[model samples]
Target: MNVYLGLGTNLGDKEQNLCRAVQKIEERIGKIVSLSAFYATAPWGFQSDNSFLNAAVCVETSLPPYEVLKETQQIERRMGRNYKSVGGQYKDRVIDIDLLLFGDIVMNEADLVLPHPLMTERRFVMEPLAEIAPDLVHPVLGQTMKELNA
Candidate 1:
C-alpha cells in the first residue's frame, strides 16, 4: 500500500532523529520509497521555543492505516515525545510522526482521520507533499497537490 508519513523534530538532534525514524520504519514495516528534502520551518501551531525540522516519507506498507498510526505514535513516544496540556492539546513533543495519508483511504472515526484533515492547508505539509506527489489528489477535495498548492 502506498503510505505517507510526516516526520518532525524540534529537540535533540532533529536531523538524526529523522534518520533514526527512517531506520526504524525500514526495520519494522517497509523500505522508504521516497523522502522529501528536510525543511526548516516555523512551528505551525502551539508556539514553542524551538523551530521544527519537517519532512515527508513515502513508503509501501502492508500495515493498515489505523495500525500504521498506532505504531507511529508508539515510535514517537519512544523517541521522547512528552505531553503538556494546552487547552487539552498535547504539546512539547521532541519528535512526532503523523500518518498523512494511507493510499486513497478516508475515514473519520473516533481515533483517526485519513487524508489528514488539515494537510492541504498547512504549507509545511503541502510543500513537501507537492515535491513527492504533485499529481496526488486530495481524497476529500479531489484536487491535485499542484491545485492545492496553488
Candidate 2:
C-alpha cells in the first residue's frame, strides 16, 4: 500500500526530528518513496509560541492501515513525543506523525480515520502533500491534493 504521512515538529532540532522520524519509519514500517520539501506553518486549531515545521512523505508499506497507525504512533513515542495538551489544547511537541492517506481506502474507527479528517482545511498538510502527490485524489472528497490545496 502507498501511504502518505504528514510530519511536523515545533520543538527541538525541527529538521533533524523530521529526518530521524522518516529514517525510523523506513527502518520499521516500509520504504519511503518520496518526501516533500519542509514547510513552516502556524499551529492550527490552537495557539502555540513555536511554529510547526511540516512536510509530507509517501511510503510503500505492506502493513495494513491500522498497523501503519500503530507503527507511526510508536515512532512518535520513540521520538520523545508526549501528549502535550492542557485542558484539551494542542501544544508544541517534539514530533507529530499523521497518516494523511492510505491508498484510496476510507475508514472510520474510534482509533483511526483514513484520508485524515482535517487535511483539506490545513494548508500545512495540503501544500506539502500537493508537492509530492499533486494528482493523488482524496477518495472521500473526490478531488486532487492540488485542488484541495487551492
Judged by TM-score, which candidate is best? Answer: 2
lDDT of 1 at 73: 72
lDDT of 2 at 25: 94
Q: How well does model 1 score by local distance difference test?
A: 0.81
Question: What is candidate 2's lDDT per residue for 3-77, written digit by digit as tens?
Answer: 999999999899999999999999988999999999988988788788899999999999999999889889998
Residue-level lDDT tens digits of model 1 in 50-149: 8888888898899988778777877777777645334446455678887888889989986688978778778888888888888988888999887898
RMSD of each: 1.8, 1.6
lDDT of 2: 0.91
Alpha-carbon lDDT, every model: 0.81, 0.91
